[model samples]
Target: MSQPRTMKSTAKKTTAKKASTAKKTSTGKKTSTAKRTSTAKKTSTAKRTSTAKKATAKRTTASKRAAKQTMASTTGTRATRTQATRAAAVEGAAAVPLPDFLASAGTLTLGQRKLLVDQALLILDQNYVHLPLKAAMHAVNPLQRLRVMRARMERQTAETMEPEWMFHRQMSSIFHSVRDLHTNYLLPVPFAGKIAFLPFMIEKCYDGAGEEHYLITRTVTGYSAPQFGPGAEVTHWNGTPIARAVALNGAQFAGSNDAANLARGLESLTLRPLVIQSPPDEDWVNLTYIGLDGSTQELREQWKVTTNLPPMTDLDAVSETSASMGLDLDSDEKARAKKALYVRDVVELEDGQSSAELKTPAAVGGADLPTTMPGVFRAREAVTPSGTFGHLRIFTFSVQDPVAFRDEFVRLAGLLPQRGLIVDVRDNGGGHIYASEFTLQTLTPRYISPEPVQFISTSLNLRICRRHKDNPAGIDLGPWFDSLDLATETGAAYSAAKPITPEDGANDIGQTYHGPVVLITDARVYSATDIFAAGFADHEIGTILGVDDNTGAGGANVWTHGLLAALLNEPPPPDSTSPYEALPNGANMRVSIRRTLRVGQLSGTPVEDLGIRPHETHKMTQADLLEGNVDLLAKAGSLLAAMPHRSLGVTTSFSGTTLTVTLNVEGIDRVDLYLDNRPISSEDLTGAPLSIDILEVTPGQSLRADGYKAGALVASRRRTV
Candidate 1:
């Protein structure tokens, strides 16, 4: 009863109409009452189910809220723990003590120290991005301190560490064992955008002083083939395709193998390498390769070698066939053929000519016919017996002495019909400076203006000795002046105007010849040739002729002993290493004992790119040489003949003890009044019919006019008073 009262199910009952109850006695009415009782029971059960569903919904909502809070608290705790752990790790790393070995060593070997510093710096760069400012600063402080310490140590011990000794020590360490040297030190050449490596290992040892030391050496015996990355293409000068193979083993170490032997080894490997090809216009291609010592080996191999390429066995036949079929030859083939042909032509001409005929020619048929002679001569063929001039002359300095060139020049000049010369220096290359000086003195005029001409110091060796400690005497006033006089019979103070040294004390002055000279030059003319050109120009000796337009004013300070000295001190890095390898003390010192410049004399000027130009330009053409047209040399001689005589007019006047001569001229600037054919003074005309004190004039007392306009002598006339 209590449960029924408490269960106010709140079910709304449906009421039937009272009027329908009047027929309640029927059968249908009796069934309807029974159904109503069953229906009411079902309705009560449905109401209980609805109430239970509401209660379960409330419990689910409350449980979900509590679970979310619990998860949030757990996640927060985990994050806090992770952060603290990371902080502790960082702090521990920062406080870690330096290794006792590193501290006790005081100073590391140059190579070892550099490697360590470079590795540390690389780590710092990568981690700095994520670290806080304080942490980054803390990391950098130790690295900077180490660098300073190393630098100071290097300076103090540099003198004691000979590069040769260091190299030997390094080599010993590398070959100690193969397994220990598996890790190679890779060096990057940023300029070349290439990478290289050395197989190295460290060994502990004691020095002669019984001091503990470590030696680092390379493992490889001789040389290592450069390992190229994937995506690299191999090509030759002609852009020929090449195939490549990865080395099964790293490069082998062969102690100081010559280039030829190395090439043979590479060929045996069947690596299919391509070599630089020769231009069709050249005799040979100068192939260069990395040597065992990491230096460039240029043309050191006696025979050319290329792997897996079709041999050029039938090249000559192919070229011949192509020529017959009127097909164009390849660039490389054409160059080789052209050079061979040129050499043949030059040899043929040289064999056919005689020395005397090439220099001077006898007037034939009284018509001044073209000279037809042979052999090497300084004079133009038109002025000599030969009507033609040779293209070039090469002296190796082995056969011809330096002093002899000047003596030969003087003798040849006197032999020529007229002093019209073409000094061909196109193939002269270079030799001793003394040789160049000798040649220059012979070509220069006997009389020089008192004004100081420019002098060049091409070598640092000379500059240091002359300008620095070696000679306390002024730089310009040294043995160099005496060297200049070696080619001449005249003393240092000898002059055409007045001989300062008495004739009794000095050798007889050499005969002076006034002539027209032309200097022919090309790019091959370097070093001593350059010095000769400058000296000639300064002294107004001759006109320079060539396509090269500028002189090498900047001197190449190269000494004969430069390479030798470097070897004695540095002894090129062992045959297995590069010359640029760091010393044991970590010092990256480069030796540039020898230096070169385009302009040897002028400091600011660069002549390497700008070549010296000729007064009259002529190119070396196959057609011209074949036709035997020596027009360039002919033109040079004709120019000299066209020049007017030096003497024009000379008149004498007497004023007290003074005697003077007035010279008349039309196209002349100033005249040299030579008393009795001896030059008196340049620009001597002070006044018209001017008088000069007789005491100053030479005793011969013959007045002559030596007038010049531009580069040519206008006229010459003489009178006796």
Candidate 2:
């Protein structure tokens, strides 16, 4: 019986292979027979493809889990990804099929064209971040405007416009007109599995004279371009000058700003490899480069095929995974450590065993500074001659529990010895609003409300509650929603008439530090962080420092809705397709329902395309890129040093088995003590550290003690029992 079962399994596997091969052969996807003949190429392709898919899936799963977990606390949404997917899938089946827009888009009747426009307008009215802006941009009657757009697209195509292409063009017109960075229509992935690529990575390079050039960074496996090794300057591609090629490609993408568009162009030059219509025809391109030896060289390079480079979605998935982990796999050491841990866990799973749980071993001497760079969620302290600075780098606001995150943040902030704090939200895309709010309150000083000022509109509260009623996170947001007083419309999204009073501020925390606050930001700082930044700026609570470019203009609350599910008002079948998936390909829209505003700002103001500007601009030089942001930190420290510095005295004493810690905090108002790396006590320092008597010491047990004054570590002492 065992032998027969084994034989059947083998046969099934063989059949799958045969079927896959037959399909490929029928499609004539075999680009290079010579490469297929190579054993190494076959193995490499298989491994790479499998790895890429697994990575993409892992990332997608993690993100889904986070969304579900954070919903209750952040948005009061009880919707699970599974439920949403199923809803989309089920409704998609019954939803009125838009005219096969791709096949006969150009021939679409005026009514059919109007239907698409109407659907889009419906979404814009309900979910656009800034409806007032949208109205201003495209205020004409939906049907009339769509008719005009269709005519324009038809004129542009000069023939029967491709349905998929036309669909994107129509959406692009609306998005471009609105000019919102977060609002754009995506088309389906143009290419899928077994696609052709140039088999090399391109990077922006600068010479001593600061002239910019495109340089080949790395040559991918299974193919070699020795002539185009690293540092080889690409002067032209496929007969077009490098600069012209970049501009042509950049124009294809809609970026939030000039910097983002240029970045996309660089990416396109590297990844958007030439595609051949037929095998053995135009399968290669000529590249003219200034070789390593300073001699100009030209070579005809054949495009390489890789099953790993699946679709745009897969690439984005991998990139998202890498970003979420705060790892640049190509460089960062901590990223490599995390990758190794991931691989180890995978190995454990294959072995039918769970990975070993990490334990916090007893601290020896003092807590050792991590040798590798910290991951995205990290708290580090630096003691400078001027003062101590605590740097908190948070990548995303997504967390399992807002309360838990708040507690951890309080604990971590208490551990740092500092008169200044640097909150770095660089490259952090937004997540849970509640989690960010928690951090904000933890960092902000106590303040009393002056009358009931509206922070959010009643309409937004009602819509959010209705939409997030089934939040799987089981967080009770009723109190929060009920607390808001609905007022007139602000026109951005909601109206604010009364303020949502602060309940958790410095007064709520055990310790409060009146310190200089510096927030590090970049163009990638978006969404919830954008809210945090705007609030901080509006209140004059901190100084915003960024790399010249304003932070990302993503101040809208996003929700994924199936196009059909929303229109039909029915749950759809379970499908894991993302709302950001291209239209016409998938019936979904990544909708922004609620717009975020600064807490204390005037009404109708939103950080849309005009993101929060930095108080001081810092630019990254070539040396900074190579050596890390040491100079930036130094500058931040200098700015922090300008603020007055205060220190407190800490003393420890023991009697019998009781340990008494005294903090002579003069200027500092708060003090905390830790024993053996565990928080023992936190108290207000009123000219004295609230003396704590702990009777936990045992004979022969070594003891270590540390004290913090107003969230900064002030003293450390070790004693033997």
lDDT of 2 by residue, 61-114 (tens): 443454344333223322242244333323322211112211222334444444
lDDT of 1 by residue, 52-111 (tens): 334334333433443354235434544453454344323322211112111222244455
Q: What is the TM-score of each candidate against the true structure?
A: 0.33, 0.54
Candidate 1 wrongly placed segments (more than 4 Å): 1-401, 446-511, 547-554, 562-611, 627-631, 634-721
lDDT for model 1, on a 0 to 1 scale?
Answer: 0.30
Q: Which stretches of candidate 2 lie over 4 Å from their true place?
A: 1-118, 134-166, 169-173, 186-251, 259-375, 378-393, 398-422, 446-494, 497-517, 539-541, 563-585, 600-604, 646-663, 666-721
lDDT of 1 at 471: 29
Candidate that scores best on lDDT: 2
